[model samples]
Target: MFDFDEMESQNLFLYLSLLVLSITFFFQNIKPRLGRFFQPSLETRAKAAILSRQEVAQFLDSPIVKEQEQEQEEGISPSSTFDFDPYMETKVELVNKALDEAIPVGEPLKIHEAMRYAVLAAGKRVRPILCLASCELVGGEENAAMPAACAVEMIHTMSLIKDDLPCMDNDDLRRGKPTTHKVYGEGVAILSGGALLSLAFEHMTTAEVSSEKMVWAVRELARSIGTRGLVAGQAKDISSEGLDLDEVGLEHLEFIHVHKTAVLLETAAVLGAIIGGGSNEEVERVRKFARCIGLLFQVVDDILDETKSSEELGKTAGKDQLVGKLTYPKLMGLEKSKEFVKRLTKDACEHLQGFSKEKVAPLVALTNFIANRNR
Candidate 1:
């Protein structure tokens, strides 16, 4: 009571010192715990952002993002920068040249001419490209699978020739030109198809691969084109003609497409992987990938036929609808068919996981090409 002001000042200094000590202690010890408690950790933050830390890392490390970044640095359009077009063009030219060399204008002019015309037409060469891509996906050179690729293409061309005959789809146009039957009468067309079919096996034998792999590939191709494969699908398609959706449902339609289209594609990829010396697991994985792509190709074909004109498709469009073919569009709505395409594309890409990103790029691009192709 006698020294009230001095006592009050002492008390204030004491309180200030206590407060400073408490703040320093909190900063030194409690701040980290509080920050961790209040703020999410990196993994937790990744989870909050709808991705795992691993997924985030993968996204950061993906080749596509890196490629896009590189392209941007080079002042190129990221949307169109992949160079897949040039890659495909180069492969197509290689396959085309090999095909020309394989089937020269030799004796038996009419049949040879028909085979060359059908095989050498302006086609997309998707099967051969798939074959070559699969070969490369398994640490093999593209040239190693050239013979097998050419054989697959020859078989594909044979199918097209047969499919366009008067006894089948009876189409007058193919690959933006006259159908094989239209250009060279049905009799010659049929003979040429048979010749190509035989030649495919013969040409495949020329591949400088192991005899075991060659035998496996040959058996696969034969099975794919036989009653269990394309023939089965074509038979179902022909039988289901003019039938209502109730009569032949999506299952039947899938059977047809799987056999008619997917089987050959599956064989092509499997052959490439086999001939390329890929392990059994790799070959099977490639088989699954190609199967999805094969179905996707047909689904897109159906959608294009329904939506685009012949000029756009470079073939007879709307023919499936006219014939009441059990197409994806015919059974399911267009939107659903498109959704199916997305699912197939995703599934196809999923099978390519174990392969190197750089090696698998062409196959991945080819998958997208088939899905998005207008023709």
Candidate 2:
């Protein structure tokens, strides 16, 4: 006899899981129209990795990676080697140059200056770097991905501006410097944020890629910032305030983080892959990998908030606890949060298994950095 009920239940569970992941930018109600735009142009895309010194000669010279290579030659730590500086140097430099040009000082001097100040500020450059790295990993020219990469940074800077406002996180410091609102008045800070947000899309439209790919990238970015994306996530977070653990719940917290943080990362990676001309399957694989890392970012943040101090973390430590914000450490124990990060890292790398090993090396190192960074 057929067990129709049991089979149906299993299928339903799988369907809902897929729906949650694929639809909501980060699990809210999905904007299917934008999601469709990022679909790969081909079924398969062949990619190459920087397997030797010759292959990486054009990029920045990474002393640490070179040292590791020397060790390999001498057969030391044969099973252990990783370096991300080369990947970071070119990316950070390029993104900074693009950013410098993206928002120049002009008439309406205050607005432009405010935008330039925040956009050109120092930070980890994580989002744009991810975009460039993803494109390179897929064997695409870094130039083709530069515009979108810069755009990603602009969006990130805008988010920080808003987050630091008295209305939001009320943060005073960022990247070891005063927040935009602290340097510029609240009015200027708000305008600067709005300008950067608009600039992200404007800059993407000007990327040298084909009209089709540019459109695709633009729509994906739109999806990430729209109603069911970052905005929704922020609203949820603010609204969830003062709610009990039982009220906000783990699922709700995850939803908030996914929408707020993960969606942008997912968009950044997907945009890079698409610009790099990845096939449909390859683009999807990268998105899944990025998705895991994006969520992992928040989890590690929660863990750090509990375990590190203000100086070590470069910001207020235990702020989440002080504010009673929902976090992995608060919901799950500190040990459990650490365990969750490990599993997420493992899952992130597993998605890249189909990629060229050499190409995915930067991402691998990046994942470790995110998991273990002190600040």
Candidate 3:
């Protein structure tokens, strides 16, 4: 006899074992390969659009910025008066002027001003500039990227305004000036921040970019600011109070920072690259660079909070410690944290291989700026 029942059971057991083995193989090897294959591998991605260090140094050594820096050395802050030669200075003035003109007047204007105040109050406009520069690096027109840049700034500003609300950081000062709630009253401040949030979408929808690009930009912005990004990160930060986290716990803290800060930055870079007509690979490369730098930026910010003064920082100092927030410096010690920043910056820059030196300068400068900034 064939022993039909026994045979059937044996065959079924064999099939089940094979199925489990297949799944195990997929997870162990095939899955990771598929993930990397579908998305570009970090190693295979193109370099960023930026200038070489020598070229950048030469450019900085040029008469224009040199004269401005010399004036500062001579005890005159160039920004104190306003000089139009250096591209950075000129860009700042242009952004500030646009912000002023864009804000309206009236009952609603009170909130508008508070929103603008948070943005226009003066700090490095690194994010917006990165957006613009990335666009140019990929051969896109600077004008084409301006709206996206502006929208990013608005989104960032709105987040700051909300982050400082009483329910959040409860901060009273920003950039050495009264916070939106302090200056405009809490209700007006909240409204202003809300207005800015809406305005970001408004700017995106109406901007010169294509409908497809606009959609992506809007989606990225929303993702960065919504539950999965800044808000989620903030929630985690608040929940982490007074808990001495281990390495894994600290990683969660890093996750919060990356979501809170890096996602938008990475989005800005990706948007610029896409608008500039960069290859998909190129765009991915810059996105990775942005992610690395974004994390570096936050780590540097934490370190500066410990080392720099409120006067220099233009905001409350030591608030990270006050809030019992886990920071790289707090967890890793100052020197190790600095080393980490350098390594991160190096990793970011390394991803920019094959990119034009002209396009890469801002990226490199950005890394150094974040790593070395005192404020």
Candidate 4:
């Protein structure tokens, strides 16, 4: 009379159905909706629509969007809205002043100029600002972060110089100007990058930060830029060329990017925390935040390469595809890649929720900006 077998089968079927329904619901929510006999139930459709509307509303309410609207009202483009000119102007002035003092007069004028050129080049010093912002978020002084910020910038510049070399990306232009190699000779370019790398350590070692903190910072920086970090990623990236990458292959690409691009950025955030005298736990949390933002940054960069012009992006567009390098857009398709970016941005922002909103505003704004940047 109990019909126990029947009951068990019924429960199993229910669970399986729920699982299928959930999968369907997830796809329907992320993908474009189409009216079909297989369409979700009315309640599911309504929920999906509501979720979509909420996401749109969130995008509209984002500070980046608000700023974009304000700029547009004043006849400025959205891309130009996040103007780095003022920030760059200050950073350049400070960096150049420091370089002048650091480099003795008549000391290999070309090397000095090349160092200055690589450091003072026009780009949004986003990574350095990220370092400062992370420090501030943990109640650290911006002045305390200056040396770390400069070191972060120097490492970043060194990476770029190396990336643009003929052995790597062979990029001819950066920041809308001729690349370091093009402006300077190939040998000089290589030396400039090497000098920048050395100077990053020099700055860190000589900075007034505590000896213990300096050791940690130096070790982390070395780890990030060495085999376990950017160089390893670059090696994998080079190996990926002309290969038909599956999902696993794509993951390798992601790993490569996480190291090649994200590690330095994440390290910057962690270093800021270290310099701020933050606890290890706090530094790791910032590292998580950086990982999310870094991946999102690369995803957005890939998307922009597919959809934007070189003129707008300030470098070669579609080079990833041209070189057969795996990318989010390549593996996930443009629409899904965009959805992935959105998810990553949301996750990145969620990580910052524990921090003060004021101190975290730039980080939040930056994730959104990276997710949506067309160029």
Model 2: per-residue Cα lDDT over 233-323, one tens digit each:
7888888876787775555776777778888887899899989988767878888788788889999888888888777776667877876
Per-model tally of clashing residue pairs? 0, 1, 12, 0
Q: Rank the models by TM-score, top first.
A: 1, 2, 3, 4
Question: Which portions of model 3 miss their true places by more than 4 Å?
Answer: 1-85
Give per-residue CA lDDT, model 4, range 1-375, as digits (tens). Answer: 899999999999999999999889978763422322233332232233234324543442344321122111121122334454464466556655554455443567787687777777666676777887788878888778777778888889888888889888988878777888988888998988888788888876766677767777777788788777788778988987776754344456667788778888888888888888777667767877887788788888888989988899888877788878888777766766676676676666666656665566656656666677666
Better of 1 and 4 by lDDT: 1
User: After aligning candidate 3 to the native by TM-score, how far in Å is the CA of 324 from where it should be?
Assistant: 0.8
RMSD (Å) per prediction? 20.5, 14.3, 11.9, 16.0
TM-score of every prediction relative to native: 0.78, 0.78, 0.76, 0.73
| Window of ten residues with lowest summed lDDT in model 2 | 44-53
| Candidate 3 lDDT tens digits, 225-323 | 777677776787788766675533445666677777777787788778877767767877788788888888898998999998888898899998998
Candidate 4, pairs of clashing residues: none
Better of 3 and 4 by TM-score: 3
TM-score of 3: 0.76
Best by lDDT: 1
